[model samples]
Target: MKILSLPALLFSLVSVSEAKKFQRCEVTTTMRKAGLDLYYGYSLENWICMAYYGSKFNSGAVSGSNRHGSQNYGIFQISSRWWCSDGKGKTANGCRIPCSKLMDDDLQDDILCAKRIVRDRKRRMNA
Candidate 1:
């Protein structure tokens, strides 16, 4: 097998590190378990971005402003007023709030949901 030149190998390593930097531990672990390496999936990256957009990945982060008029719920920063009943137990709470409630745990429903989204996107792109 031909060996990659030093510069090419270094570039590859850098790209991977940049990709993993923002990924949540939960997303990282799950994707690996599912047989997706950096070469195969951008699922981890997408989920990390979503988490930031949702609530900066703060498992305990809540949102409310004196001007905003309501408390957003949990890590996914779910807005309770609109999704209140739907988000009954989706808050960050537990030995790490990941596998329990859908919102609170970083690895909860979001990871699985992300996996589905990424997989679909990948399929569509390939098709």
Candidate 2:
């Protein structure tokens, strides 16, 4: 029988918990196909830049508390205060999704939520 050391087991577990980060070009291509390239009149470079600054393309990224005691989630760092529910505070939940969903490997839900946020912002600005 083979025995694994405790450190090795912990390392494996930690690695499993870490999310995969997208390359800049890969993110650009995916967002382009998702129609996010110019969804909010923002270019592909803009989206890539936001993704890089927000979470460094890490789908599992979660931010610490903001001034409103809300956190940001996922690659775009969508706020828990307005976009999705984090279950520990009040949220408008404009995306109508659990914040954890945004952290998944699949980005469909994240993209949808981002679009909703952008639309809402545009509406507010136009109003």
Candidate 3:
């Protein structure tokens, strides 16, 4: 057996093959644990609906490119244009994360970034 670099090991652990397709119940529980139950005044049901429509509960799902040639990622369909960086072009990167992170099974980062989006949208609407 050969020793693998730390980065290599981590990559192997988080490979695309490890991507998840969460069930509805799993999404509900995970969303609740992430405090998305009523985040930004949107009910958990609202978020669940969006996630289902956006990704069909597939963590590894990627959307067709937008007019900007940037794709949306993961269950939330977080956009590469304004939210996460896709490394193909410049982005506002409002989420301060790589687009890949949004496509992973783990969702804390996605939830946090989505919260930022909602907050920003709310602020703009209020303004």
Candidate 4:
């Protein structure tokens, strides 16, 4: 026969904070899903590195203004002056997308805008 003790602990509760940012692995996976493995001579690693350096994989990151006062948005830190419209200043609206769309957890619009930026850059270089 065994006697139970009142002080015996059954299990300890672990407190885990909610994740507000994506891990590097998650960023890579998302980039791959967006079909940008080698798009425009940029490898998957290159894209991942960009996200890490740009916003530490935070999808809602917004960067400060550059010398031209153009802010960047999202994990890729897309520019507002030329690519996306921040509605704060004049923009070319090359992507025809609002900057707010880039600063969300959803990445579809961000990836599409990134593709457009790259494609447009290529066009300008060859022209």
Which model scores highest in lDDT?
3
**Residue pairs in clash, model 2:** none
Between 1 and 3, whose lDDT is larger? 3
Whose TM-score is greatest here? 3
Can you write out model 1's per-residue Cα lDDT over 4-49, one digit (the tens) per residue?
5877777778732111113467655754675444434455465455
lDDT of 4: 0.78
Off by over 4 Å in 4: 1-20, 122-127
Off by over 4 Å in 3: 1-17, 122-127
Model 2 agreement with the true structure over 1-127: per-residue lDDT tens digits = 1356876777778833335688888888889999987776877787788889889999999999998999999998988988899998999888899999888777788888877877775542121
lDDT of 4 by residue, 11-113 (tens): 2344432224888887788889999899988788888887888889887888888878889888888888888999898888788998888887777888888
What is the lDDT for 59 in model 2? 96
Per-residue C-alpha lDDT of model 3 across residues 46-127, encoded as one tens digit per residue: 8999899989999888988888898889888888888899998879898799999888888888788888888895442121
Ten contiguous residues minimizing lDDT sum, candidate 4: 10-19
Model 3, TM vs. native: 0.82
Locate the minimum summed-lDDT window of 10 residues in model 1: 15-24
Candidate that beats the other on lDDT, 2 or 3, i.e. the better one: 3
Colliding pairs, model 3: none
Q: Please, what's the RMSD in Å of model 4?
A: 9.6
Ranking by lDDT: 3, 2, 4, 1
lDDT of 1: 0.44
